[model samples]
Target: MPPPGTFTILLFGPAQDRAGSGQVTVQARVECTCGELLRALGEQHPALAFALPAARLAVNHALVAPDHRPRPDDEIALIALVDGG
Candidate 1:
């Protein structure tokens, strides 16, 4: 479980559009993985529901695998997929 008083997250590209900012801070309830955090965020922000499927998450700038645990102060970034040529 997260020790106390801290949670971290970042938003980029179109994910930032949904969050309306490039950075976000949330209070952590229990120590969890990046996926859990994303789920929670989606719950808190319904507008993010649609974006979740296409979004990518990173922990401390490194892409997090599906079950990667999140540290209390881990810098998480949500990236929205973009396509172009």
Candidate 2:
């Protein structure tokens, strides 16, 4: 389990591959918006920076806007964008 105010992010597809793991935990005691989390993830994993911008964010099993701020226990999933028709 993550600490208080921390959200667990489950990486998928290329995001997971880039992260080299299936999940990541982020701490947000002040204000942890989905966008901020993405940025933080990029900082933690440089490879993610390229994918974070194009990655789709889902919170708690629901697709959320970029500005959405997830709370503790919220499940965050980062889905990488795939190029092709």
Candidate 3:
């Protein structure tokens, strides 16, 4: 598990492809908002920078607004838009 003041984000679909992994650790305050997390994600994983705008952050299995502050126990996932017919 990541140390305190960091977030472990679960990646899915294209996000996983870009990051070359199923998860990533972002450094931020415990009170950081979802938007800040995304920013940290982009900074930490430059390959995923372009995809940030369209991606969504899920906390505790529910899609949350950018301003939402996630708790340590919250399940955080980065969902990229899946393209299919």
Candidate 1 least-lDDT 10 residues: 1-10
Q: What lDDT score goes with residue 45 in model 1? A: 69
lDDT tens digits, residue span 1-85, model 1: 5457356567666767877877766654656767777887787767667778977687787887867877776677776676668
The residue-level lDDT of candidate 3 at 59 comes to 93
Which residue ranges in model 2 land beyond 4 Å of their true spot?
83-85
Best by TM-score: 3
Which stretches in model 3 have alpha-carbon errors above 4 Å?
Answer: none
Q: How would you encode candidate 3's per-residue C-alpha lDDT over 3-60 as one tens digit per residue? A: 7778889988888887889988888998999999999999989998877889889998
Ranking by lDDT: 3, 2, 1
**Location of the lowest summed lDDT over 10 successive residues in candidate 3:** 1-10
lDDT of 2 by residue, 15-42 (tens): 7787789987666663777788778777
Q: What is the number of backbone collisions in each predicted candidate, taken in the order shown? A: 0, 0, 0
Residue 71 in model 2: lDDT = 79
| lDDT (C-alpha, whole model) for all candidates | 0.72, 0.75, 0.87
Q: What is the TM-score of candidate 2?
A: 0.78
The C-alpha stretches of model 1 lying farther than 4 A from their native spots are: 1-6
